[model samples]
Target: MDEAPKALQRFLAPFMEQLTQKNLGNAVELMNEDERNEFDRLLGLATEPVRSFAPYTF
Candidate 1:
């Protein structure tokens, strides 16, 4: 991540916020927001299960 470009980091900010917050349902909700919904949703889905028991359920 340290090597990632600034724009890439900015673009991923929202998804990172949601991931850090551990809001699974918000991932789905985030899909409806503007600003690269595809990327946000993808990352959201990918990171939602951190520190969770249902690691692979979704």
Candidate 2:
């Protein structure tokens, strides 16, 4: 995240915070289509393994 551009970091902050707080549903619900797409793309770039317990209907 520290390596991300300022604007990108700012754009993702709220969703990242929600995820950190374990509020997946809220984060998903709050994202518009574009946001959701970008988030999904970013998730693919994660170095560490990621897991999701619930299916997201994006």
Instruction: Indicate which candidate wins on lDDT.
Output: 2
Every model's TM-score: 0.29, 0.46
Tens digits of per-residue lDDT, candidate 2, 1-58, equal: 4343454556667776767564556677779999888766665554435456766755
How much is 14 displaced in model 1, in angstroms? 0.4
Q: Lowest summed-lDDT stretch of 10 residues in model 1?
A: 1-10
What lDDT does candidate 1 reach at residue 33?
A: 50
lDDT of 1 at 52: 48
Best by TM-score: 2
lDDT tens per residue, model 1, 1-58: 3333454455556756877565546545565456556556545655554464867787
Question: Which residues of candidate 1, in runs, are more than 4 Å off?
Answer: 1-4, 21-58
Q: How far does residue 16 in candidate 1 sit from its true spot (Å)?
A: 0.4
